[model samples]
Target: MQEIFDENVFKKGIGRQINLPFLKAVSTAFKNIRVRFGRSFITIGGIFFSLTFLMSTFTNNVIAQSLLASGTDEVKFLLQPMAQEVQARQVWLISLSLLVCIIGIMNAMLTSVTERYREIGTWKCLGALDRFIVELFLLESTFQGLIGSIGGAILGFLFPLFVNIGKYGTQVIEVLPWLEILKYGAITIVIGLVLSIAGAIYPAYRATQMVPADAMRQEM
Candidate 1:
């Protein structure tokens, strides 16, 4: 019975040890985010605006559809020019905006790695693995993306309502399909998360390649 109890204790210890690296990396990432709140906020803001812009295109398309379905000649005529412009340029605009977002995220993460050179060196010297460093940065960006995406989606959904209300009052707002708007919001969130991860890949890889000695020599 004593031997069995010892084995169980050992297994539990092993399980905790196995989870220690992930927990440490996550904790360190959160600590760094708190310490570098300004940079993180900038990154999140960029993501929020980019996603909001992208989702605005989707919102515009939906609004155009609603206008077309209204069966009012005056409404159709009023929206026709705008609808054509959106159809012609929406894809290009979304693509350009998404590209900008990715670039912004990558730049932010790279700057973060550069600014934290000394801390990273310390972690390396303290026996942190390369993958742990990568994981830490990725996790931080993922959290930022999540917050930014939700904020952007909310703003995007409201944008059309405001515009329509301003143009034709609240009665025009009823034409919108709430369910479709929700679906577009969900897509935007997924896109934001994916962009965050994709943007971090190069910076994370570059960070892993840094020599601890060289990083430590740099001024913070």
Candidate 2:
């Protein structure tokens, strides 16, 4: 009679043998971004434009004030009450755009999970664990978030600056609120990172639940 294999001992041995490297997951994430640029672009664009909207809303008044004149003292006094109203509206707009951004990211990543069914199975068949798969997707989102956030931040500030310079000349840059701008930029970047990662979590969990046999049988 054949000797029985101890399942628990076998599992312990396999666990000890597997070593997943962080660099490997990071490299795979970069490769996937390049190989799937079109999808990656869509995901990044959602974050990019959303952050752009946010940054513009954030600094619109500050830049406008520096470039435009309030006229007589009476005009400044008249607009004071209205500023709060305008800011409240902007807050609503920002909140809406960010919600859409989060949804867009989740949808795009879900698509990726479906598309990579065979790839996921191949990795699983080769002894890849669920944690490795999750890590790959998270890294992809992190990089996308970083690029989109930085690009959006630059464009958001530069576009406004260009428009103001055209309309008001160089004076706009001279009196610029650099400190406030930097603070908003940093805050926006953090938001982008958190949103990107948040959007990927569900899809990553879905991917981890895939059965290797079924996933491998998937058409695409």
Candidate 3:
């Protein structure tokens, strides 16, 4: 009724390198994402929304500063630097958004662990190590985060730009800090990746602790 790992093979493998390749873990992560499309979508969307808000505010602030630095009387009439209190409020909002996104991701991953009880058990039975399980979870979250953050960063940057263009005319494009925008975009992407990986850490650790027999017996 049940097939467990071969005791002899398990015993022999104790002295050898049996950890799965990183590429294999990555492949499995991709498959998991494809299989759990809806959950993956929500997880990615949360990351996207958070990063979009972050990038948009930063872009807007940068735009205001650039317009001011242009030394045009028009800039004074058209835009004003954000007040200190306003900037502080925006910072609070951004921090809250990111925190919510991380919590959402953590919940999604934990649900995944519960749903894939049998699958995880099978992997362990076939010699998959705890580290492999952890790697898979991290890879999954990172992939989702990478896609979401990149999309968010581009959308966030462009949306404010378009709005500014309407307000300041196409000439406003010439005044933007292109180099600075690129730098911030790069930093935002890194933050997204770190955020997703951090969210998955606890879930990944949970996956590693599953007992093969108990997990296989679980009903998803």
Best by lDDT: 3
Q: Cα lDDT of all candidates, in order?
A: 0.85, 0.85, 0.89
TM-score computed on alpha carbons, candidate 2: 0.86
Which stretches of candidate 3 lie above 4 Å from their native place? 1-17
Q: In candidate 1, where is summed lDDT lowest over 10 consecutive residues?
A: 12-21
Q: Is candidate 1 or candidate 2 better by TM-score?
A: 2
Q: Backbone clashes in each candidate structure, one number apiece? A: 0, 0, 0
TM-score result, candidate 1: 0.85
**Candidate 3: which pairs clash?**
none
Candidate 2 has which clashing residue pairs, if any? none
TM-scores for all predictions: 0.85, 0.86, 0.90
RMSD per candidate (Å) reads 6.4, 3.3, 4.6
Residues 1-220, model 1: lDDT tens digits: 9999999999875555323378787888888889999999999998999899877778878877887787367778887777777687878888888999999999999998888888888777666777888899999999899999999998987886688778766656778787898899999999999999999999999888889898889987
Error of 2 at 192 (Å): 0.6
Model 1 has an lDDT value of 0.85
Per residue, candidate 3 scores C-alpha lDDT tens digits across 1-220 of 1235577677778756368999999998999999899999999999999999899988988887788778378766656554456678999999999999899889999999999989999999887889999999999999999999999899989999999888888766988989999988998899899999999999999999999999888887
Q: What is the lDDT of residue 184 in candidate 1?
A: 95
Best by TM-score: 3
